[model samples]
Target: MFPSTEEGPEDDSAKHGGRVRTFPHERGNWATHVYLPYDAREEFMDLLDTLLFHAQTYVPRLVRMEAFHLSLSQSVVLRHHWIHPFVQALKDRMASCQRCVPRAPLCLSSPSPPRLPFLS
Candidate 1:
């Protein structure tokens, strides 16, 4: 997950260019990745809340996520200029594909094309 605020000097995240890097950094390059967004059902939200309540007892700072997704690709680098075109191309390809619908909560449990609401 990406955070807007700086991790501070005590945080070693700033060392070696960044906390971790898949490829060498370049001035105009940007990191990119793909994922399947999920819209949790009411049942899942309830379950998550119950889990969070118990988890907060141990880790009080734990924050609830507004949304989450299943990562489909590892981090990849792209030129800043290519960002928009790359997204548009991905959207075009996805628009042509058929959507999958599975009753199970996790989409990765399904075959080939994942069964997720956003992918549709």
Candidate 2:
């Protein structure tokens, strides 16, 4: 079955800048995020394939992720006018941090975290 196309009430939180917006849909604005990148190898691909196969049996609509990474920040909405400055700030901050050394796949867990194996 297809999902509904009905629209909901407009969210005014961004205009007020009260709560941090998770998903922003303002026209001409883009969501930006920082992450620790990883190169997925054959073993990791195989594991993901196996997991997706099993998951889809229960949730048929589940789709495999095309890319994966460890997010360092929450999704932040960037207006068209602020994109360059925001990116430059991120670049400056990243340049100050020591290069990251990719570690073996770690099983990260939190009391309420999503159940999944994330590569560090």
Candidate 3:
């Protein structure tokens, strides 16, 4: 990780901080790994809450998965020029990566019963 001009320790500056990490996981050839900067976790959660709240009423499965899930709806609030393009690009990327387009119905329902969050 290199440093950027904007913040924190030289090693933790924004430009360098925003860099994402990727590696091949030993678990499987198809399993690529990603590690987001630690500081971004909280911001991610904030955005997640906003997305979940906005999508909840429209997606019953979302309500069912409330305990743990990611709602891509937050992408809707990204720069106006980016919204549709980003989604389309994501779809294209997924299609190429998976080697086939998935035809299953979109479902957000949890596969298992909800579990309580661990709080300390």
Which candidate tops TM-score?
2
- Please give, for residues 1-120, the per-residue lDDT of candidate 3 as tens digits: 344544432333345334332332221123211112223346657887789888877984453222343332311123445456555765565565433343552556532332211110
Flag regions of model 1 displaced more than 4 Å: 1-26, 107-120
Could you give the C-alpha RMSD of every candidate to the true structure, in order shown?
9.2, 10.8, 17.2
lDDT of 1 by residue, 1-120 (tens): 345553423434455334455456565778777888988889889999999999999998676788877776656678999899878877887887788886665544434432333324
lDDT of 2 by residue, 23-112 (tens): 657666887766777677899899989999999999986666667788665565668998887767667666767775656656544433
Whichever of 1 and 3 has more lDDT, that candidate is: 1
Q: Given candidate 2, what's the lDDT at residue 70?
A: 80
Q: Give the TM-scores of the predictions, in the order they appear.
A: 0.54, 0.60, 0.22
lDDT of 1: 0.69
Compute the lDDT of residue 89 as modeled in candidate 3: 61
TM-score of 2: 0.60
Write down the worst ten-residue block by lDDT for model 2.
Answer: 111-120
The collision pairs in model 2 are none
Greater TM-score among 1 and 2 belongs to: 2
Query: What value does the lDDT take at residue 119 in candidate 3?
Result: 11
TM-score of 1: 0.54
